[model samples]
Target: MTSSIRRIPRRMPGWAKVLTAFVLVLVVLFAGVRLAVLPGLRDLFGTETQDRSGPALLKSIQDMSRYDAASGNFQVVVDLEKDAKYLPDVLHGSRTLYVGAGTVDAYVDLGRLGGNDVTVDADRTSATLRLPHARLGKPALDPDRSYAVSKQRGLLDRLGDLFSDNPNSEQAVQKLAVRHIGEAAKDSGLTARAETNTTDMLQGLLSSLGFKEVHITYRS
Candidate 1:
């Protein structure tokens, strides 16, 4: 009778151990499915979100850049809502005029007219300008057009050309910018919901001018 009782307890222990092992295996499988398999499937088959307005914005920027040099009446309308945090003061305070040929000249308020002129050469290779307190050297102007400088080989020019040549480059840049913007919004205590408002405002203004994409980098 005592031996039988001991055997019953021994059997109970074995059964309990088996049940625990089975539960552990089930838990592991459940986690694996939820964490790994589902995410993999979604990445493989999910529909990509496309920004439909990008093309129109890019076209507008290109058109603004292509203004005729003879007219001297070109205007670049910036969408403030999309890029207000970084662009508002610059756009409203400083006036950037497109010189009929290909150059861009910006004049900032210094309490007087013609106080300063920051000239970005036509080829987009170099810049020449006189700031309020700083003086810049004269750029070597191209013989064909006395007002604009010849295209120079530079790191920035090379990178810009690379992005222009590769389709993936632009997408990569957009992704990076979006990530940075998200981070900025978080750090600034701004809600992500505001992004839509900014993007919409920008789209409206850019669509009118035919700009498909505007890549902005903030400086100190």
Candidate 2:
């Protein structure tokens, strides 16, 4: 029995196994940083390096003061039903329940500012800018978060589903949901916050660039 027993194979050194695992971990980490993490970080902190106008360099680059401060993700379950006006409901019937998520962004646009909207003091010590009214961007539906929660279709509708083309009530529900998200953004006071944030950011930036006084105003 002892002679028949299989000989044991030599084990690898503990240090060699540890080194292999460490290399694998490093490769994974590097791959993740390169593929996913770095690109997003770059966009969040990206800045333009346009020339600083004038010898004194008191230029007001009223370049779009984009404030992506107010962000909202809204989830809504919308029910859509086809109506039978003056006819039997069973003839056309339907209902689709959708669970959708929408993303909205509100920004303060200084893009309306022209050369006259910016005022730079003679000694480059003071500056003032007139900013345009803040506005909300279009609501975008996130396909990942947006989908049909549950749909109950009438027999005729289910039969029609197999056929060629027909108007989708779900699309109408989605459009309404998107419009609601946009209205919600306006009611959420995003514009006020964007204005305040833009003002503070421009003040600090100008103050740092040798301007002792910075004035920022918004117009409707």
Candidate 3:
């Protein structure tokens, strides 16, 4: 007598099969359009960009009186999302992942110094200076280096873009990024670093001017 063996094949679920077919169709369509139609269209009709804005007017210039003690470069990632109640993300929601690069400058306002802010000793061998604490400037975002890493929009959003002028606006995310960067800079000891640098600079300058003793203090 010989032994017999039986084998049973597994079948994929109906929903899974449908989902796989849908995904495959989308992929094929996207690939075909990207590899075939896009290049042909570009070759047939080359693209041209035009700038129609008027020449920039010269704005009023103000004299700067602050000493830039330290400049801090910062980067932040902003993830902004909006969801509709009881609606799936694919149907009515948006999410954006943005990477923002910016710079914050800490400065001391030398122009605010009063006549008595700096005092020289009668012997001309010692000096004392009173200066204000360093303040951080507004965050300036770098457009070249800052950009959206990824964006996901619902079907309704995509449909609305067809009629909207500014379809892809990153203003919300950009603002959030700037705010985060500013907060980070405040906690990064940037102001302390700036104060140290300013003190060192003033001390060196005064010493070079023949003052053997230089004392510097900052006002809150």
Every model's Cα RMSD, please? Answer: 24.5, 21.6, 12.6
Cα lDDT tens digits, model 2, 83-184, are: 657655565667778877888877776556889889998999999999887777899988787888676655456446647476344677788778777777
Q: Which ten residues in a row have the lowest lDDT in candidate 1?
A: 66-75
TM-score of 3: 0.80
Q: In candidate 2, how many Å is residue 174 off?
A: 1.4
Question: Worst lDDT window (10 residues) for model 3?
Answer: 28-37
Displacement of residue 137 (Cα, Å) in model 1 is 46
lDDT of each: 0.34, 0.76, 0.89
Index of the highest-TM-score prediction: 3
True lDDT of residue 190, candidate 3:
84
Model 1 lDDT, residue 102, Cα: 17
Ranking by lDDT: 3, 2, 1
| Candidate 3, 16-97: lDDT as tens digits | 9999986876686466557666757656655578999999998999999999999999998899999999899997899999
Where is model 2 more than 4 Å wrong at Cα? 1-69, 86-91, 165-169
lDDT score, residue 4, model 1?
46
**In candidate 2, where is summed lDDT lowest over 10 consecutive residues?**
153-162
> Which model is ahead, 1 or 2, in terms of lDDT?
2
Compose the digit string of candidate 1's lDDT tens values, residues 8-36.
44355888999998687668646655765
